[model samples]
Target: MTVLALGLNHGSAPLDLRGRFAVPLDALGERVQGLRQHLARAQPEVAILSTCNRTEVYVGLPALGASACPRHAMELAEPAIEWLAAQGGTAPAELRHHSYLRAGADAARHAFRVAAGLDSMVLGEPQILGQMKAAVREADSAGALGTTLHQMFQRSFAVAKEVRSRTEIGSHAVSLAAAAVRLAQQLFDDLPRRRVLFVGAGDMIDLVATHFAAQKPLQMTVANRSTERGRLLAERLGAAQLPLAELGQVLGQFDIVISCTASSLPLIGLGAVERALKARKRHPMLMLDLAVPRDIEPEVARLPDVYLYTVDDLAQQVQANGERRQAAVAHAEAIVSAGVKSFSQWLDQRASVPLILALQRQTETWRQAELAKARRALARGRDVDAVMDTLATALTRKLMHGALSELHGSAGEAHQQWADSLQRLFLRDTA
Candidate 1:
C-alpha cells in the first residue's frame, strides 16, 4: 500500500458535477468516519479536503511488503473511490471519469502544490491553505489522522509558507472573491451606487463582502440563517443584518446580491428572484453564487433582468488574470519540487525501519551471548586479557556468520552480488 490522492478539481470536473461531490465542511468529519469504516480492512488514514473548487480524499494505506510493490496504485485507491462515490450518491464510473489519482511521491507532490495554492482555480490564492488547515483539523478530530498523513500535511503547510515567503507568487493573486467583484463591476458601472446584500455569513461570503465593501457600496446588509452570525459580519462591515427568512421580502431592495451558504440546497430560487426583479420594476440585479451545491438556482440566470454567476463563471474571469503571475509560478514550483524530494526521502527511510530494527535486534542478541561467555570464562579463573580477546573473537565471528555463510553458499553472479553487498555494508570507509 501507498499514499494516494484521489479527487476531481475545477479543471478536471464541471461545476455541476463537482457540486455533487462537495461535502459540506461541517459534515466532513462524518463523511471521513464513514469512509474509515468502509476501508477498515485497509486501515487507511484518511483526510477529506472539500472546498468550493475541489473535493479530494487523501489516504495513507498500511505499508505493504516488497513483493506487493508490483500492485497498481488504483487497486489500493479503489476502496476510497467507491466510498467517496457512495457518500455523494454518485456512480463510481462517473467519479472515476473526472477524477485523477496520485500515488506515493506523486501524492506528496500534489499535497504540497495544493497547499501552496498552485492547484487552485486562482493561481497563488491564499485561501486554499487555510481551507487545507481546516480539513486537517476535521480529519484529526474524526480520529482519522495517522503518522503518514499528519506528516504530509504538516510538511505541506511548511512548503506553502516557504512558497509564499520566498516567492512573489501571491503578488498578483486574483482570488474568487476579487473576481466576483470584477464581474459585478462589468455588469454595473457604479458599484458605489448599488446596494449589496450578502446572503450568508460564512467565510466565502465574508471574503466577497469585504471586497465589495472596499468599493463603499451605497448600502450593504448581511442576510443569514442566523441573525446573530449575520449581525457579527454586518458589524465588521458597518452594515445592517437581517434573518434569512426575510430574504425574499427584502431581496429587491438590494441591487447586487452575493450568496454562499452550506445549505445543500439553493437559497435563492427562480420565484424569489423573479419576484425581486418585478419589484425592482425590471431593474437589473447582479447575483454571484460562490457556493458549491449552489446557493442560487441555475434557472435564476434565465430571467432577463438578473445576471447570475457561479463559482465556475468567476473562475474563468480569475484565470484571465493568471498570466500576470506567471513569472512567480516557476519560483513556487521549484520550492514544491524540493519539498517533494525531501518528503520522498523521508518516506524511503520510513520503509527501511523494519529491516533496521531486525538488524539491531540480531546484533544485540549476539553481543549478549558473547558477553555472557566472557563473564563465565573470567569466573573460571581464566586470564582477563585472554577472556577479553576471546570475547572480541567470538563477537566478530557471530557478526560475520550470516555474510560468510551467504558468500560460501553462492556461486558466480549470486556470489558476486553477496560479495558486493557485504563490502558496502561492512567494508565501507568511515572516519
Candidate 2:
C-alpha cells in the first residue's frame, strides 16, 4: 500500500486551532482505531503525532493500479479530513484551509524530516522524537499500525539517530524550559532568592521544573490534584508537594510561578493574582502558563506586578537561537535524503514479492519433474553418470524453455527487447 500523511501544524495553523486537534494520551489508541474505520476501503493504517506545535495523521493505503500510476491517495484524503474534523470537533471546512496532504514518497520524506526535528517549532528539539514513538506505540496497540506504517516509523527513528550521531544537529539547542528561565532572569536579578511554585506534574512541567531547579530557587513546590503523582516528581527533584487546592491560598508566598496543566479552564485568574499581589504589597511576580487552554487567565497579564507568559511567549524567546542551528540543517537534510532513497528502494522490492514467489514455484515444479525422470532411469539399471548428466541438462532446458518460446514468437521491437533480456539473464557479464 502507498503511504499518505495529512494534517495541520504550527506552521499551517494557529495555536487555538491546533489545540482543538490535540488527542489526550488516554484516547490516542481509540482515535487511531476510529481513523482506520473511517477509511477502511483505503486500507487505513494510522498513527497520530500531536504535540504543542503540530497534530499530523499518517495513513497507509493500497497502491493505485498501474493505469493510475502517479495518482495521489486523494480517495483516502477526503474521508480522512471529514473523520479528523469530526474527531477534533471542528468544522471540516475550517480545518481544510489549514490542512495539508502528502502522498507516496513525499509522505515518508516528511516523516523522516519530522522525526529528525527539522519540522519542530524549535529547530532540532529532541522532545518530538519521544512524542512520535509514543504515538506509534499507541497505534500498534489499537491494531491500526500495519506493515507500511511500521516500516516508515522504524526508518524515521533510524534516520533520526543517524542524523544525531553524524552531525551537530542538536548542538547548542534552545528549549522551552530554557526560554522560561531566561525570561524569569530578565525580571529577577537573583533566582536563588525567588520562591517558585510549579503547577501539574506532566512532562512539560517536569522539564520546566528541572530547569528552574537548576537555579536553586529558595522554595519550590509541585501542585497537582493527585498528591501521590506530585510527590513522586517532588521527591526526585528535592522539592515538596502541595495540594492543588492550596494553590490559591499560597499564591502570595511565591515570587515566580510556572504552570502547565491539562485542565479545561484556567487554574489562576486575574482576581487571584491580584489578591496575591496585594498580599505581597505590590511585589512583582513572574508567572507562566504553558498549558494549551492556559493555566492562568490572559487578563492576569494586565496586572501591574504580575508577569504572565504563555507557551507562545516562551516560543518567541527561543527563536533567536535558530540561526546557530541552521548551519547543521544541510548535514541533517543529506542524511534524510539518503534515508528516503533507501526506503523507496525497499518499497519497490516489496512490490516485486508476488512475481518472485511465482518464479520460485515454477522452478520447483521443473525440478520435481527432472528428479522423477532421473529416479526411473536408475531403477531401470541405466548408467548413473549418464542419468545424472541427462537430469542436469533437462532441468536447464526446461528452465530456459519459457523465455525461449516467448522470444521465438516475438517480432520487431518486442523481439529485440526479449533478446536483450534473455542475453542478460543467461550470459550476465558477457551480455
Candidate 3:
C-alpha cells in the first residue's frame, strides 16, 4: 500500500471552513472508527488527525498501476471529504479550494513538517505536535493505525524533534496562547485590573491560563464541563472554579474570557453574550474563542460591547514575531528537508520488503532441494562422507554463481572496477 494524506488547515481554509471540519475531542474515536470501517472496505489502513488548525486523513492503499493511482486516491479521498463537509454543513466545492491532497513522499514530508510546526500559521507552534499525537492516539484506539500510518507518524515525531533540536525555529516564535494574551493586552491597558475567565480545562485553556496568570489578573476563574477538572486547574493558578452551568449567570463578572472547548456546537451564543453585556452596562468584554468549532457564536462579534475573536482573528497578532523568526526559517527548512530525505529513504526500504522476502524464499528452496539430493546420495551408501563433502561444496558454489556472473558482466566504470577486484579474489583462485 502507498502512503497518502488529505487535509485542510489554517493556511488553506478560513475559520468557518475549518470549523465545519472540526471533530469534538470526545467524538474523535467514534468518528475515526467509522472512517476506518469505510476505508477498510476499499483499503487496509486509515488514520485521522483532527485539531483546531487542521484535519488530516492518512491512508495506506494498494499500489495500483500508474493510470489507476490517481483515480483510486481521489475515490478514497472523496468520501472522506464528503463526510467532513457534511459534518461542517458545507458543500464539497466550499472546501475544495482549501483542501490539499498529498501522496507518497510528499505526504510523508508534509506530515513531518506539520508535526514540526513548519506548516503552522504561527511557525514553530508546539501545540500542533501534541494535537497530532492526540489524533494518532485516537486513530490507534479506533484500530485505524496500521504499518503505513504508524511509520509515517513515528518518523513525523522524530523529524519534529530533530528540527526543534537543530534549528532556532521556536526561539522567538510567539505561541498562540501568548499571542492571545498580547491581543487581550492591546484591548485592555491594565491586565492586572481586568477579571479573566477561562472556559475549558484542556491544553489550550491551560496554556491561555498560564499566560494570563503571569499578568496576575484581578480575578481568574476556570469554567469547564467537568467541575473537578476546572477546580484542579483553578487551584494550580490560585484562581476560582465554576461549572459550565454557572457560566451564563457569572459571565458578566469577567472583563476577559478565553474559551477553548471541544464542543461540536457553539457554547456561548450571541444572546447570552448580549445579556452579559447588558448586565455589565455595556462594558467592553474581550473574548477570544480558540476552539475550532468555536465555543462562541460568530454573531457575538456584532455586539457593541462584545469584542469576539476567533482563531483567525488572532492570525494577525501571531505574525507580529514573524520577521524576527525569518532568519531561522532557512535553517528550519534545511532540517526539514534532510529529515524528509531520510524518511523517504526509509519508506523506499519498506517498499523492498516483499522483494527481499521473495529472494529469501528462493534461496531457502534451493537449499532444501540441495539438502534432499545429498540425503538421497548418502542413503545409496556409495560413500556417505564423500557425498556430504560434495553437498557442502555444491551449496557454496551455487550461492556464489549469481554473484560471480554479475561481477564478470559489469560494464560501468565504477561497477567494473569493483567487479575486477572481486573477480581477482574469487575467480582467479578457481581459474
Candidate 4:
C-alpha cells in the first residue's frame, strides 16, 4: 500500500470550513475506527491529526500490484475523501474542492513538516507536535494503525525533535495564547485593572490563562462544566472557579474574556452579551474566541462595545513573527527534506522484501534436495570426495540454471541485457 495524506488545513481552507471538519479529541479513536471501516475494501491503515488549524487524514491504500505507483494509489483517494466529507456532513465535491492530497514522498514530507510545526498557522508552535502524538495514540488504540503509518509518524516525531534541537525555530515563538494577550493589551489600558474570565479548562485555556495571569489581571475566574477540572486549573493560577451555569449571570463582571471549549454550540450568545453590556453600563469588552465552532456567537462581533476575534484573526496577528524567522524556517525545512529522502529510501528497500523472501525460499529448497541425495550416497558407502563433488556440481547447476536458460533463449539486445544482468548478479569481478 502507498501512504497518502488527504485533508485541508488553514492554508487550504477557511475557518468555517475547517470547523466543519473538526473532530472532538475525546472521540478521535472512534472516528479513526469509523474511517477504517469506511475504507475496509482497501484494507486501509489510518491516522488522523485534527487541530485548531487543520484536520488531516493519513492513510495507506491497497496497491494494484507490487509495482503500483503513487499516481495509481492517488486514484483511490475518493473513498477516504468521501468518508472525511461524511464527517462534516458536506458533499464530496465541496470537501474535495478545499482539500489537498499528497502521495508517496510528498505525503511523507507533509507529515514531517506538520510534526515539526512548519505547517501550523502559528509557525514553530509546539502544540501541534503534542496533538500529533495524541493522534498517533488514538489511531493505535483504534486498531487502525499499521506498520507503514507507524513508521511514518515515528520518523516524523524524530525529525521534529531534530528540527527543534538543531534550529532556533521555536525561539521566542508567538503562540495563539501570546497573540491573544497582545491583542488584549491593545484594547485595555492595564491588564492589572481588567477582570478576566476563561470559559473552559482545556489545554488551550490553561495556556491562555497562564499568559493572562502572568500579566497579573485584577480578578480571574474559570468557568467549566466540570467543577473538578475547572477548579484544578483555577487553583494552579490562583483564580476563582465558577460553575459554567452561572456564566451568563456574572458575564458583566469581566472586562476581558477569552474562551475555548468543546461545545458544538456557541457558549456566549448575543443576548447574553447584550445583558452583560447593559449591566456594565456599556463598558467595552475584549473577547477572543479560540474555539473552532466558536465559544462566542458570531453576532457578538456586531456589538459596537465588544472587540471579538476568532482563530482566523489570530492567524493574521501571528504571521509577522513567522515572517521574521525565515532563516530558522529554512533550516528546519532542510532537516525535513533530508528526512523525507531517508524515508523514501526506506520505502524502496521495503518494496524488495517480497522478492528477497522468495529467493531465500527457492535456494533453501534446492539445498535440502541436494543434502538428501548426498546423505543417501553416504549411506551406500560411496567415497566421501565423490559424493562432495557431485553435491557441489548439483548445487552450482541449480543456482545457474535460470540465468543460463535466459542467455540461451534470448537474442540480440535481449541476449546482451541478460548477459549484463547475470554478470552483475553472479560475476564478482565483472566491471
Candidate 5:
C-alpha cells in the first residue's frame, strides 16, 4: 500500500480547532490502538503524530492487488480524514477545509520537514522531533507500525539530524519561553524588579521558569495543579511554590503571569484579572497563555491594565525575530530536497517489489513443470541423458511461450507494444 499522511496543524487550523484534536501524552497510546483496531481489516498499518500544534495520521494501504496505487491513496484520503474526525468527534467537512492530505513521496517529505522543525510555528524549534518520536513509539507499541511508516519516520529522523548538523537553521531559533522573557522586558525596564508567576508544572512552565529565572526576578512562584511538582521546579529556580487552587488568591502579587496547563477551560477569567488590576491600583500586567485551549480568558485582553498573549499571539513575536534564520532556509531546503529525492527512489523500489515476486514465482512454476515431466520419463524407462535434454528444452520453451504468443498474435499498436515489452524483458541482459 502507499504511505499517506492526513491531518491539521497550527498553520492549517486555528488554535481552537487544533485543541479539539490534540491528544494528551497519556491518551495517545489508547487513541492509537483505537484507530488501529478501527481500520484493522481494511487498513491495518497506521501511526499517529499528535502534538500541541498538530494531529496527523499516517497509514499504509495495499497498493498492489487492489485499487491501492498512489492515485488510489488520494481516494482513500476521505476515509482517513473521516477516521480522524471520528476520533476527535469533529465534523469531517469542517476539518477538511484546514487539513493536509499528502501521499507517497509527498508524505515522506512532509514528515521530514516537520521533524526537522521546518514546518513548526517557531522555525527550527526542537520540540517537534521529540513529539514525533513519542507518537511513533506509541504506534509501535500498539502494533500499528508497518514497514512503510516505520521507514518513513526513521528516515525522517535521519534527515532532521542532517539538517540540524549541516545547517544553521536553529541559529536564530526563538522559543516561546524566550519570547515571553523578551516581551516582559517591554513592560518592565528592570526584570529584577518584576515579580513573575508561572502557572502549571508542565514542560511549558518549566521552560518559562528557566528563562524568567535567569532574569533573577525579585520574586518567582510556580503554581501548579500538583504542589509537589511545582515545588521541585520552584526549588531549582530558588522560587516559591503554591497549589493551583491559590492562583486567584495571589494573582495580584505578581506583575507578570504566564500559564500553560492541560485544562480544557480557562484558568483565569476576566473577573479575576479585573480584581487583580484593581488591587494593584490599575497597574498594567503582562500575561501570556501558552496553552492550546488557553489557560486565560480571551476577554482579559480587553482589560485596560492586563495584557493577554495566547500561543498564536506569541508565535508572531517568535517569527518577528526569525529573519536571522532566513539565510539558512535555502541551505535547509536543499537538504530537504535531496532527502525527498532519496526517499522517492526508495519508494520506487518498493513499488516494483510485487512485479519482481510475480516474475520469480512464474519462473519457479515453469521449472517445476519441466522437472516433473523429466521424473515421469525416467520412471517410464527413458534414457537419463535424453530426458535431461528434453527437460532443458521444454523449460526454455515454457518460459518464452507466453512472451512469444503475445508478440506474434498481436497486430498494429498491440503488436509493437508486446514486441517492445519482450525486447526489454529478454534483451536487457545482452544490452
Candidate 6:
C-alpha cells in the first residue's frame, strides 16, 4: 500500500480554521476507530496525528489506479471539520481556507519537520515531539496504525532526534510558554503585582507557571480537574491549588489565566469570562489557551476585558531568530533530507516483499524437486557420496541457469552492463 498524509496546521491555517479542525484528546481513539472502519472498506490502513499545531491523517492504500482514497479521506475529514466547527461555533467553509493537504514524500517530510519543531510557532520547540509521539501511541492503541503508517511515524521520530542532535535546531529555543511570558510583559509593565491563575496541570501549564513564577506574581493558583496533580505543580512553584469547580467563581481573582488541558470541550466560555470581567470591574485579563481543542471558547475573545490568545496568535510573536539559527537550518535540513531519502528507500523496498517471497518460493520448489531426484538415485543403491555431490551440483547449476541464459541472450549495451554488474557482484581478483 502507498503511504499518504493529509491535514492542516498553524502555518497553513489561521486560528479560526485550526480551532475548527482540532480534535479532542479524549475522543481521539474513537475518531481513529471510526476512520479505520471507514477506510478499511477501500483503504487498508490509517493513522491520525492531531495536536494543537496540526491535525494530520496518514493512510495506506492500494495503487493509485482508480482508487477513491483521496475522496475517502475528504469524507473522513468532513466529520472532523464538522465536529471542530461545532466546538468553535464556526462553519466548515469559513475554516477551509486555513486548511492544507500534503501527500507522498512532501507529507513525510512535513511530519518529520513538525516533530523536529521546525514548523512550530516557536521554532525548534521540543514539546511538539512528545505530543506527536503521544498521538502515534494513541493511534496504535486504537488499531489505526498499520505497517506503512507505523514505519512513517517511527522514521519521523528518528529524523526528529537526528535533527535535534546533529544541529542547533533546539538550541537557544524559545518555548510557547516563554513566548506567552514575553507577550504578558508587553501588556503589563510589572508582573510582580499581577495575580496569575494557571488553569491546568499539564506540561504546558507547568512550564508557563514556572515562567510566571520566576516573575513572582502577587498570587498564583493552579486550577485543575484533579486537584492532586494541580497541587503537585502548585507546590513546586509555591502556588496554591483549586478545583476546576471553583474556576467560574474565582476567575476574577487573577490578572492572567493561562490554560492547557486535555478537556474535549471549552472550560472557560464567554459567559464565564464576561462574569469574571464584570466582577473585576472591567480589569483587563490576559488569557492564553494552549490546548489543541481549546480550553477557552472562541467567543470569549469578544469580551472587552478579556484578551484571549490561541496557539496560532502566539506564532506571530515568536521571532525566527533568523541570523542566530541560519547555520543550523542548513544542517538540520540536510539531516531531514537524508532521513527522508532513507525512509523512502525503505518504503519502496517494503513494497517488493510479495515479489521477493514469490521468488524464494520458486527457488525452494526447484530445490525440493532436485532433492527428491537425488534421494531416488541413492535409494536405487547409487553411491551416497556421488548422490550428495550430484545434488549440490544440480542446485548450483539451477541457481545460475537463469543468469547464464540471460547473459547469453543479452545484446550490446545490456550484455556489457550485465557482465560488468556480475563481475562486481561475484568476481574475486588476485594480484
Q: In candidate 5, what are the lDDT values of residues 88-138, reduced to their tens digit? A: 678899888889888777788899999999998888888889889988998
- Provide the overall lDDT of each model, using Cα atoms, as 2-decimal numbers: 0.88, 0.85, 0.82, 0.89, 0.84, 0.78
Off-target runs (Cα >4 Å) in candidate 1 are: 64-70, 322-324, 408-417
Q: Which 10-residue window of candidate 3 scores lowest in summed lDDT? A: 62-71
Candidate 4 local lDDT, 81-116, one digit each (tens): 899999998999999899998888888999999999
Listed per model in order, the count of residue pairs whose N, CA or C atoms clash below 3 Å is: 0, 0, 1, 0, 2, 0
Of the two candidates 3 and 4, the one with more favorable TM-score, higher being better, is 4
TM-score quality measure for candidate 6? 0.81
Candidate 6 local lDDT, residue 193: 96
- lDDT for 286 in candidate 2 is 90
Give me the displacement of residue 312 in model 6, in angstroms: 1.3
Candidate 1: residue pairs that collide = none
Which candidate number maximizes lDDT?
4
Writing each residue's lDDT as its tens digit, candidate 2 over 1-431 gives 67788889878887677777877776889888888887887677899887777789998876742111333566657788899898778898988898888887788889999999888767778888898999999999999998888999999999999888888878756778988898998999899999999899989989999999999989899999778989999998999789999889999999989898777678998889989999999999999888776678888888888888778777777886453465688889999999988877777777677789999998899899899999999999999999999999998898888899999999999999999999888889885
Candidate 6, 1-431: lDDT as tens digits = 55656677777776545655677666778877877665555555666677777777766665431123556546545545554444446676765666654455666787888888887777789988988888888888887788877888899899999888888888857787888998999899889999999988988888888888888889999999987898899899999889899899999889999998877679998888888889999989999998877789988888877889987777666774342377887888888888778777776677678889998998999899988999899889999999999999988888888878888999999999888867775574621
Model 4 alpha-carbon miss at residue 368, Å: 2.0
**Cα deviation in Å at residue 193, candidate 5?**
0.8
Better of 3 and 6 by lDDT: 3
lDDT agreement of model 3 with the native: 0.82
Clashes of 3: 1
